[model samples]
Target: MKKAIIALALLASAGIQAQDIYTPGEGEGIIYFLPKTQIVVDIIATRVDYKPGEFGLYANRYLRLNNVSTRPETHWEIKDIQVRTAGIPDSTKAYIMKLKDKSLESNIELTDQGIAKAINTTSSYKEEQPEYKLQIPQKHENAHQYMTEDILVAGSSAKMAELTAREIYNIRESKNAILRGQADTMPKDGASLKLIISQLDKQERALTESFTGVTDRTDKVFTFTVNPEDKMSDKVFARFSSRLGVLQADNLAGDPISISISNSSSLPAPVEDGKKKKKIDGVIYNIPGKGKVSVSFQGKIKWENELQITQFGYTEVLVDGLFDKKVNTRVVFNPVTGGVIKIDKD
Candidate 1:
C-alpha cells in the first residue's frame, strides 16, 4: 500500500510538469499567437514631452486595429515587442502596458416576446477586448533638438505586424540612448575620414576597372597618369566636394582641393519652372612642385560678357614629402554621374 501511494504521487508530479509546457489556444493572450499569426494596427496619435526629473523624453503612441474582422474576436492575441528610432541621435526605452479597466459597450433593444425568449435561451458569448499602450522614453541632454514625430513598425515576418511594431519601438529607444552617450565624443577627424575615403575607393573600383601596364623607360622613376575622360558623374563630384569642405572646416591645414563645373558647348534649355540645368566639365589637378592647386570648369553663362567663363577654383596645400610618403589617393566620377576625371599622384 505504501509503495502504491508513493508511485501515485510521482505520477501526479510528472503530470503537472507536462501541463506546464507552452501550447497555443484561444483566449490565451498575446503569447498564444507566437506562431503563425497576422495582426495589423494603424497609428491613431502620438504625444511626446520632456520628463526632466526622469532624465529622458517620453513618447506615447496609440494604434487602432485594422484587421480585426479577419479572425474571430476570441482568437486575437498580441505578443511581446521591441522599439527603436529610425535616424534620431539618442537612444529610447520602450514599455508595453495593458489597460484592464477599459471595456466596450453596445446597445440593443428587443420586443416583449423577444426579451422573454432571450431570457430562456442559453448562448455562449466571448467579448474579450483589451487596449494596449506603449511608452517610449529617450535620454539626451539635447533630446529636443533631434526629436522626430514619425514612428515605423517593421514586421518580423509577413504576419507579425504587432510584434514588429513593438520591436521597432524598443530599437529606436535603445539607439537614442546610445547616441545620447556618444554624440559629444564622436570622432571629428583622423580614422573616421580614412574609413570614409576607403569606402569611397571600394565603391568606385566596383563601378569601373583600372588598367595597369609598365611603361618602357630607361629611368628608374615610375609614372602613372589618369585621364579626365574617365571621370565620375556630377553628383559624385558634388559629394566629394562636400566631404572636402567638411575636412577643411575641421582641419584648415589639411590638403587643399578645388572643384568647378562648366559647360562650354550649347546653351542649356530652360526648365519648365524657370530653372536651368547647367552642364559643367571640370578638372582637379595636382600641381607638381607648386604649393598652390587650381581647378578649372567651363560652362555657358547668362553674363553680359564671356559665353564661357573659366571659373578658377584655387586653394593652397601643404604637399611636403607627400609624393615620397606614397599617399595612395583615387579620384573617380561621382557615382551619380558616369563622367571620369584626372587623378594626380607624385
Candidate 2:
C-alpha cells in the first residue's frame, strides 16, 4: 500500500507540476501518507423485560399490588449516543522526503500506516481502545432462599403467595424496628447496621416479587462508522424499535436514526493561477477542514460535534529549505489531522 501510494503521488505530481517538483536522485527517502478522519457512532440502548409471577393475577386481591402486570412484556429505551473520530491513511495525500543528501539524520518519522508524525524528532502514536466495564447481568436472586417454611410447604401458589406477603411484611417491620432502635438485637457499628438493613430490604423485595412480578434491565451497544466525502443530510445511520431494541439502518421494523454531516471549514478557497509552470521543493501536508456532525432521533437532535476531516481540506507545503539552514529545524505533525503541531530551530 505504501509503495502504491508513493508511486501514485510521484506520478500525479510529475504530471501536474513536473518543472518545479524535486525528487531524490536514486537512493532511499522517507515516504508518508496523510490521514482521513472516520467518524464512529456508538448507540447505547437499554432493554427491560418483565416476567410475571405465578400469582400475578391474584396480586391486587391478595397483596394490594394494583400495578403488578399479569402479562410478560419487553421494551427498549435509547440511553445515549457517543461520537468519536479516528484516523486512517489517505493514499491521495502521500509524499516522499528525499534523504539521499542527509546521511546523518533519520529526520522524518511515520506511523505504522505511513502517516507523518515527527520531522527531525522522535515520536509515536498509539490508538487507545475504549475499555468497557463488563456489565455481567446479575442473576435474579432465588426467591426460595427468603421463603418461609410455611410458604415453601404450601399446597397452592395462592397459599405460598399469602405466606410470602406476610414474610415480606415481617421483614419490613423488622427493618423499621431496627431503624427505630426498638429491635431486640441491634448492631454495634454503623456499617453493621447498614448491612442488616440492606439484607432485610433485599429479602423483602425478593419475597414481594411473588406478587409484584420481576423486571430485568440490561444494556447494549451498537456501533456505526461513516466516512463522508461531502455534505450529507438526514442519512439513516441506524434504527430503533420499542420491542426489538437497536437495529441496523435497513431494518424496516424500527424508526430511523438520522445522521447529518456538513463541511464547516473556515479556510478560504485557493486561488488558481493561470500559469501551469510550477516548481515545488517541499514537504506537503494537509490543513484539515472542519465538519459538523449531528445525530437526530424522532426529529430531535441527540448529539452534535465538530471534527477535523482531512478529505474536506486542502494541502499546503513546508519548503525543504527550512532544514538546510545552519541550525537544525525540528517539526511535528498531527498524524490524524495532517496539520503542523510545532516548529522549532535548534
Candidate 3:
C-alpha cells in the first residue's frame, strides 16, 4: 500500500514537470521534407541556373512544390551555402563554413519517422579577417656561379664586382632565412596558408551570394522550421533549432500567433536566485476557469502597476510570499537560460 502511494506521488510530480515545460500546441508536431532544388543546364550554355525557394517561413506556413525543374549539374562545382531568414538573429541563424568540401554546408538528410531534426552551426570568424590580411610576397633570386680564381679581386675593376657580390649576398641571406624557417617549421594557423584559406572563404561566400536569387533545381535541399506562436524569446526558437535546419513548421497547428515579434525574440534575462522578483515566463492556469494561459504583456509590472492578464483567459490566483502578498500567477521560467524566473506558488 505504501509503495502504491509513493508511485502515485511520483506520477503526480512528473505530470507537473511536464506541464511546466510543455509548449502550447494543439498536438505537438514536426514537419519533415527531402527539400531539393531541380537545376537545369543547357548543353551549349556556359552557365547553369540554380533555383531554390524564396519564401521565408512562419510556424504553420504551408509549402508544396509540384512541377520543379530537374537538371543536375555534372561538371559544376559545389559551393558551401549558408542562409538565414530575415528578422532572425545571428545567434539563431546557422551558416555554412568553407574550410573543406564537407564543412557544414547543408543539412537536409535528418528526418526520422516523419519529423525534421534540427542542425546547428555557428560562424566564429566575422569582420576580423578584413582587419588583418595575410599576404605572402614573392621573392626572386638569380643564380650566380664563379670559379675560385675569379673569386679573388684581381684589379681596380674587381672592387666594383666585390661590392655587388656583397649586396647580392645580403639579399640572398634574408631570403634564405625566411625559406629555412618555413622549411623547418609548420605554417602558423592564420598566416600564409590560412590567408589562402581565407581567400577561398571569400570566394565561397561570393559563390553562395551569387545564387541568392536562384531559379534552377540545383539540388539545394532543405530549410528550417520555426514556431511563430511560442512566446519565449531567443529561447523558443533556439530550442527548436537544436539539431541543423531549424524544425519545420508543417506540423504546426493554427495560424502564426506572433506577427512582428512575429517569429523570434531576444530571450529574457535570468533573474538572480534569492532576489525578490516578479515574473511571467511560463504558461499560467486561470484560477477562475481551468484554461491554460499566455501573457502578451510588453513588459513586467508590479501589483500597483496595471497589468493585462484576465483578458488572456487567465484568472489571477493569490499566493503567500509572492506578488501583492497575494500573487496572481502561474509558473514563470525562462526556457532560454534554463532558469526559473520565480518560484511557482504552491
For each candidate in the order shown, give its overall lDDT on alpha carbons: 0.22, 0.75, 0.25
User: What's the TM-score of every candidate structure?
Assistant: 0.12, 0.85, 0.15
lDDT of 1 by residue, 206-245 (tens): 2111111011111111111111211212211111121222
Whichever of 1 and 3 has more lDDT, that candidate is 3
Once fitted onto the true fold, the runs of candidate 3 whose alpha carbons sit more than 4 angstroms away are 1-174, 177-223, 227-322, 325-340, 344-346
lDDT of 2 by residue, 76-118 (tens): 9898888888888876555555543542123677776877787
lDDT of 2 at 218: 80
Candidate 3 or 1, higher TM-score: 3
lDDT, residue 242, model 1: 18
lDDT of 3 by residue, 259-341 (tens): 11121223232345997755432222221111112211123211111111111122222222232223423333221111223
